[model samples]
Target chain A: MNESLFPAPAVALAQADVPVWEAVRFTAEGLVPAIAQQHDTGEVLMMAWMTRETLAETLTTGQACYWSRSRGKPWRKGETSGQRQRVLDVRLDCDGDTLLLLVDQDGAACHTGRRTCFYRAADASGTLATLTEPLVDPEVLYGPGGGHP
Target chain B: MNESLFPAPAVALAQADVPVWEAVRFTAEGLVPAIAQQHDTGEVLMMAWMTRETLAETLTTGQACYWSRSRGKPWRKGETSGQRQRVLDVRLDCDGDTLLLLVDQDGAACHTGRRTCFYRAADASGTLATLTEPLVDPEVLYGPGGGHP
Candidate 1:
């Protein structure tokens, strides 16, 4: 803990009474960064942009929904594949600019059929190393030509 | 693990033996999502955007440097607050769109003086709840008028 020398009063107050969606501070473009993590393992799976509508939908649906920046539409996780994320919890950052979603994933959280999207680690020599392999194949998950770039 | 029924070949291959910066797939804006986590605790402190220059600088300097979209300038962690991040490890996500940094945080990661930016957890009733308190005062971290919005 970084104890303050001045010992001023804490400024971060909880907005517990407010609605979850209302409490978020969305960007000017009406988007927020949302990170999904595996509920039990605590492994961060993937990150996506979410809109206020998708957020509310996620809460109501009890599943993960996000705004696809590239597709310019709402993205319901596992709609294309069977890798839906059953949201266990939703968290808002102090700044309200980011979100953390703890979820019980039905399948691989990554589109590439990996348990996690983070699989490459940089070594001391600055070389990238692949740490984990895909537990399933992308082709099997997305079908031919459905693989992500 | 959700094993594929078809069990096709893996499409995601290792981009090992390449320069760390080159392996990353930056957005059209030349930016990548960077997540900083506490090395020992595995606590995700914060998420920021990093340019290629900042990523290289971080690798070379062993310090976290991010591009401040709001300031439209380079943001070296702890430059003003003395809450520098001593990076211990760097990991790149499968799509190369996200970077995970394992770091030793010096002080509060949130400008609100909280240990982590993520402090609000949404309850079953859809109300937000503040989870963590500030470890230090924002005034002490950034001086008066330095408080974040």
Candidate 2:
């Protein structure tokens, strides 16, 4: 990935008295959507929700942290599955409601162990087709439950 | 830039009796977040909410349509600014909670007349810095009102 496209936010967040998280415009639910994309490949890995706390932590730590709405808790990437993302660049959209992260992915970003969560593509018949198979079994990633929460 | 990464959804949407929009899992608010990216460059254009009606219309017409939460109405991308997006590929994330749309953007994707909505990058101090300027003036894009709703 081109590091020059955007500066890494870790060093930046570390120095800022006024954190970048302050600029984010959270929704009524106090959440914003964050999209993580592979830095070099430009492959979008996943989309997740981030609260201000998670966003601040992510920027400061240079790791991906998100709010798991289903579990009602903070979800740290790679905490369970070891598929962590190293944040290379952080960006806010013009409206400040969305975030884009250029990341160095450790392994498959999907809980299914696929390279990306967006493996199902609309096919020539408007039917969703599975384009990629899981590289690692879910049981292998998340243990007994075999799925992420 | 490769079309082979995913098949174009336009031709596919035209043939299917069971529309792909049905596969989407909208949130409790009856909406799903749709991310538009440049099909060729992999540049993320914008993120917007989509209702079933907007999503269906988009899939069938091969154009981008969204629910304007602010306006509380259906928004055809080019309706106001002529910055339409011709959708090339449609993908659903593993959980069916998000959509990835690969599109050919007509002009600026942001109402600010930037090629993409994500133009501000977090700098070395966690402060956002504008990385790119608007290619077209906002007034030119949206008339005298000067800003999008």
Candidate 3:
């Protein structure tokens, strides 16, 4: 993880401003879809779900924290593979349901070791093609099973 | 709208390929979040929901179509405002629950007349700030109440 880019953790909310967490509209499952995008380049990296606790942690720590549906726990981005995303800004849509995270990504965002999880695209012919190649070996990131569920 | 950029409507899906819509995991509400990103720039413009029919329509028509929860109907992006999104490609996450639409967006993507619906960012101090100004007047697009529900 890029330590220098990390924002001060657990900073106090401004006294005059409303709490950020209040505006979020979590699903029935207490989860919200969070999309991570490169803060400067605007390249969307990956999307995952966030529970209230994880979202609060992400806001306080200024790092990406997700609620892993399969693992059934909090999964810190790059906690295992070092592809940490330093939070630059957090946004909620007008309806207050979805989240948009502008982050400074340290490395490849995909467990497949690609810069982005969305590296495949479907053409008009309905054929799926790889839009981007893996930047690092999967073995180097998650070891075996390629992080598959 | 860029007519030439539109892929042929209802182009044949390759026989060998599995139809993408089958893999999607809609929520209990029968909705899946579909994110629209600028194909070339990688800028995420908006996040909306899609039903199976809307998803199919988007694929066959090569345009962005969504399920408007408020209106309870299929909403063809730019159908009313002339801010259509021409689909360049489509993608599903590994779990096939969420959708990513890579498209060429025409005009503002937000009903508020902003390029993106997510125009507010919350800082560590809990202050909310406008990140982008509206590209056009909402009155010019949606008129009157500006589509606010």
Candidate 4:
């Protein structure tokens, strides 16, 4: 029904599920890289790792879910910062190796309290620019948002 | 020197170089997903794609660049619509596969002329809610500012 964005011909929405083992095929360590992008504008937010369980939960829950390599567990986005993302649509690239997720992000996507974890841009000329300011103060967003900061 | 959001100081600012051909290794398909967010408000904008050359050019040009498979070539952000994005930084995951770009965008990041590509949110009960309106008409942004009817 979303003719404007889809590949056209408007195929019926498939409820097909991507198996877990097949999903984690691309592993850097114990995790596979997952890229998060804004569903509508097509802007990329950040790249994180995801485990089998986390990926399945994300697909089932429709929230932007990821596995934290540092934490060594499945991390539902915004669990700490309250900046959650809800999945809009999920797309698999032609090769079915990389994933394209269309998400409805609640607040900042970056744990640093920035809209995205990508806050720095190193240009071809070797000029690095910080594009956006922190949307929310990290101490506070990561904190209780009450008396932490 | 930028402060590291993570504990590793200066390590985050450390620059790493990637070769062109090996730079982009998409999943099963050649389609590598990219995330886009608002430069000002820290709002997520959209996600697109980038090939090896596009990735190299993007690094060299400092512009938010991508390889549009549909258009079958490199698609520079805002090149056609005047919504150009100036690259602030680019990051790769530990896997050296996926890409993360921080950009200073000009106008609406979305072809729909919205500040970001992501204008939707999921309600508490798990329903997606579209929050904002299109900043610029898609016809205007994609075609001509005033071209489309």
Candidate 5:
């Protein structure tokens, strides 16, 4: 096992030696953040986190598989809503700390039935403004928008 | 005056002490990268670089601005196309090294007259796939899409 450099726990000294998964995984705080973008239009869809296992699923299946930090388990984008994001390219920056995923988004990426979750904007004064009108109704997208009240 | 960190012969660092640009600004090869996302859709439209002056303009004008490395000058997003991206929020990550600019993007964000710039995806097998189809014809968008061969 190789020694870690910075102030953090060493996950595996063999991480560099043997490649168990196709993706190069690194956990910043037990979770690796991923930035997902629309493959064709360069539109950033959303940002999520994934574990080594989830990353492997994306690489192997050509479909996005994320480990929901909130749910604490695996997640298939659009699995329930039919808005799955098909994997096109998985890229890592020079640092190998973050991931840039190119995907073919089947439908809206947001539970609100919009194309993405970031439908609001925050101004310098911290005022939140609605950015775009919904493309699809939330009632039609998610079973009551993920069953939220 | 505090000693300047970046080697910018073009920039004058006289007011170095009074709330000047961040130290990370100087370390960014004199050009900081900016991420643009569609405000309503939360789709990441594109990524471009910015100089300090342009960054200042964007904040002051409430518009999307970028530093064109090719032209070696400033560019206002959608200025010529009328597809301008109105700035909603500008954020610096925890490290303050990178920037995220959320904007209300009007019309298309790409010169090809497409809603976004990422139009293709490459898989693990190096196979490229088309993700999004163009909304507007490129001829009018680019003054011509590669022109009649």
Candidate 6:
């Protein structure tokens, strides 16, 4: 990956003077796990992979950007669907392998049009149950393709 | 990995009749990302990697178990640090590449003694700041060695 496309490392330094991307432990595919949470509600919206380029774009734009492993490209949140995640804060885990995004989410975060990706819960009987209903029709969000863009 | 140690696939099925671990997309190292969130507060406590064995252990034991990539072993929560995370619910992402753990966390979830692992946030100016303070001293939790057991 070309590091030149990203902002200067010094400009995006995190805590302890460590460069944000420098501290991340990306996988062999150059992807890191990022979790988006509702800043006020503490509700976890979704989890996605972010490449160095997407991470940089997120930092610069104050918007959530993720790496689409299948598409092999950067995906700006709400680019195809109107479910944008406006970043309120960005955090890296103590180990720096994971990321936390406190965001002001608009509309559904899941492709299924659910408010959050985690709509299922396992009960004491070890049976999984859907905990929520889709807030919007998924077809409306993804169009006739019925898949991510 | 030994599949025999895990419960029968029929007995550990999740929603849609999918076996709990069958649909998981483990990395080349046989590891998957797991996020621990507070069951009541919905606050994300920590993120870790879990191997098939650890994931099975967590399901059967109803506790959080993770694989320590550095130590190359399964580490049960609160084994040495007294920071146990009791599993309340477990969910898989639509892509089946990530796991969400709703847990009743005991004590601090962070090695730094913070309630959550993500205690720092970066602002629009790209400046990092601490969002929370340590709930306990690191020395008290890890003993004087200041390293994982």
Calculate the i-RMS of every candidate, to one decimal place: 7.2, 5.6, 6.4, 9.7, 15.4, 7.4
Worst 10 residues of 3 chain B by lDDT: B1-10
Residues A69-102 of candidate 5 have per-residue lDDT tens digits of 6577888887777788987666543223356687
Clashing pairs in 5: A40-B118, A40-B119, A41-B116, A41-B117, A41-B118, A42-B118, A43-B44, A44-B43, A44-B44
Each prediction's TM-score against the native?
0.82, 0.88, 0.83, 0.51, 0.48, 0.85
Model 4 per-residue lDDT tens digits across residues A17-99? 43334433555555555667665554556677666567667777888788766566678887777888877565432223345
- Which CAPRI category fits model 4? incorrect
Report the Cα lDDT for candidate 2.
Answer: 0.81
Poorly placed runs, candidate 2 (over 4 Å): A1-19, A123-126, B1-19, B147-149
Model 2 complex DockQ against the native: 0.42
Q: Which scores better on TM-score, 4 or 5?
A: 4
Q: Classify candidate 6 by CAPRI docking class.
A: acceptable
TM-score of predicted chain B, candidate 1: 0.86
**lDDT of each residue in A89-119, candidate 1, tens digit only:** 7878876788988788887878778887877
| Backbone clash count for every predicted candidate, in the order shown | 0, 1, 1, 27, 9, 0
Give the lDDT ranking, best first: 2, 1, 3, 6, 5, 4
Candidate 5: misplaced stretches above 4 Å? Answer: A1-99, A102-149, B1-20, B23-28, B145-149
Note the Cα lDDT for every prediction shown. 0.78, 0.81, 0.77, 0.57, 0.59, 0.76
Which stretches in model 4 have alpha-carbon errors above 4 Å? A1-149, B1-24, B144-149
- Model 6 residue B100 lDDT score: 88
For each candidate, report its DockQ versus the true two-chain complex. 0.38, 0.42, 0.30, 0.08, 0.05, 0.25
Best by TM-score: 2
Query: What digit string (tens of lDDT, one per residue) describes model 2 on residues B98-139?
Result: 999989999899999999888777753577766677899989
Better-scoring candidate (lDDT), 3 or 4: 3
Please estimate how well model 6 matches the true structure, expressed as its whole-model Cα lDDT: 0.76
Which is better, 1 or 6, measured by TM-score? 6
Task: For model 1, state the Cα shift of residue B82 in Å.
Answer: 2.4
Tens digit of per-residue lDDT, candidate 2, span A56-83: 7887899999999989999999998988
